[model samples]
Target: MQKPALDIHEIPSPGKWFLLSIQHLFAMFGSTVLVPFLTGLDPAIALITSGIGTLTFILITKGQMPSYLGSSFAFIAPIIAAKASGGPGAAMMGAFLAGLVYSIVAIIIKRLGSGWIMKLLPSVVVGPVIMVIGLGLAATAVNMAMNDADGKYSLTNFSVALVTLAITITFSIFGRGFFSIIPVLLGIIGGYAFAYTQGLVDFQKVIDAKWFAVPDFTIPFLTYTPGISWTIILLMVPVAVVTISEHIGHQIVLGNVINRDLFQKPGLHRSLLGDGVATMLASLLGGPPSVTYGENIGVLAITRAYSVYLFVGSAVMAIVFGFVGKISALISTIPTPVMGGVSILLFGIIASSGLRTMIDDKIDFGEKRNLVIASVILVLGIGGAVIHIGQSFQVEGMALSAIIGVLLNLVLPEAKKGE
Candidate 1:
């Protein structure tokens, strides 16, 4: 018997729908704004990119499943590394290429099935790599919260920072209902309120800022000075491989939650294309590359309102806020300690995701070969290992770690039978 046709428009009451949309918005709020804040991109543009990306995802997925696409945290380290080595524009170029990488992988998945892609990125390799990605940036997030971009200690009130961090941690660990999902937002609010009491906030920026303004979109321009570092490009490309796996995993989770095979229906190809296009769009507009947000999955589990229209409402709200310069200023003004406090949990969650990936796959951890591969990748990646073969030729850090992992897997002999 054919399953009853699911109703895409069967939304709950109008009031409930709006409330649920707000829940999703809050779930995605902290990380979305935090991306541009860290990368030195216009926060308004990040908002626009996220809004546009989410909308594109919905349309491409044919409204079959509900999810939100937002600014990716994985790109933060890469962007910073690129800016230090090249410039901000170079980082954008690398990110743009990364989007293209996603497209190519998507096409490959379409042709060969996702199993082939999974073989290249098994749980052991991906798990440690992702954990390293988070732990690698742990110090940076803490440092930023206490100091300004200039490295000066603007946060004279260390107590406030501590309080902010405490609030975020407390709420994240023990808070109930929607509050738990929004610990970062609450922490920000708590920190900002404390800052206001202490006269730390500069209201002039908020007052002087225009109520409505266009997003400050910038185009990527090629430069010969840095001369297109192949090392940087190659380093960033494989990161996309991990993100693509995340995309597929998210799709599967959402499919089960909503009781629809989104991968086969709207087709995984189209969803991948949509994500690629959105990331390219974000990169062109001077924002970090975009990715499907997993936090929205938490929202889905909580609300149990699997309607796509709620996501549509979120997209509309985010776009409307994107045009508001004052709102961007307010978000930009969030105190660092609060962000630091929040990052304590957020970054940990990122690392935990890697662990979950490994656990979910039921990786054969006892296998000597698998154990060796995972250990080497984790240590090399997190230890800041570098390889230099003369002046102009070198590979280092996560790039080197990823390449070494892949080579080790291919070259190493397979596990013996009945070992």
Candidate 2:
């Protein structure tokens, strides 16, 4: 029972188009901005870079794909480590190297028809990895949801998060049209208004801020710091394994939503190239690394709006907002609990999508090899086991788990078709 999809070429009226574009932007905002908020990067720069990255993706894919590039949660820990060890320069360099890894993969995929990708990382591996990603971030979401004014855990913040979560769930399940599609935005508004009644919001910054101010952009290698080495690149590039798996999973989900084989047209190679180039550009500008946003996919599932034109509009709007400091500052003032509430739903959907992938493909969970691969990947990923090499090199969490899963899948022989 698939709903009819809006064609890629179909254009709604100007008013409707503007609203839909903003809805897409709203869909991506919580996740996109959170990367910068968590990693101490400039939110304005992140937005601009994401906007550019997304446009680059569309161009490279020949406007066939409808996706928005946002700052990747996968790189949060690595970036933090890189910053502490060397500097922002080291961190950006690491991300740039990760992009190079994507480029190399794209080259391989272009030549080798992507069949090996499925053989190496099937549903048994990817599904558990996706589950681990959501579970791994559970603590962060809870902490933020309970953070008080003094930055300590408090029941007041928890209450607000609960209210936000409730509203979001209600709207997503029952609300009609735009309300249903943009539940996260409505949830934030509802929670923010409630907080305002309690005098939690500070309006001083908004009042003091100018109407328009140029964005403070930083060039990573030139302005942020100076230095790049093979060690930094090696430590970071391999982490692309997790993001790549996530990318493939998302493409599969998007194909289901739109009822089209995106994997065929434009194909994985083009998408990977687009993602790699965009990520590299973002890193060069000291912005957090970008990835295709799963949040937007959730929006499409809810709204059934599959027009690529809306994505272009969203990209243009993000670029416009990036040039305005006051707007970015205003968005930054959203309460932590509000975002925490959204994250709970958002991350859950991502995990569920992975499950959907497994079920749709009818992966044989009864098979001993499949069961073992899934089991090991989930435990290692969620348990936070780190493999340290000397002082400067390490791989752990989802990245390490994904690598292990791939290797195991390679070594294990699959059962004969009818066995």
lDDT of 2 by residue, 299-376 (tens): 778778788888888989988888776777777777778778777776677567667767877978899998898889
In the range 286-342, model 1's lDDT, one tens digit per residue, is 778888887887777666677888888888888888899899878877766666666
> TM-score of model 2 relative to the true fold?
0.89
Q: What is the C-alpha lDDT of each candidate?
A: 0.77, 0.80
- Candidate 2 stretches with Cα past 4 Å from truth are 1-6, 10-13, 149-151, 226-235, 256-260, 295-307, 416-419
TM-score winner: 1
Model 2 / residue 408 / CA error / Å: 1.2
RMSD of each: 3.1, 2.8
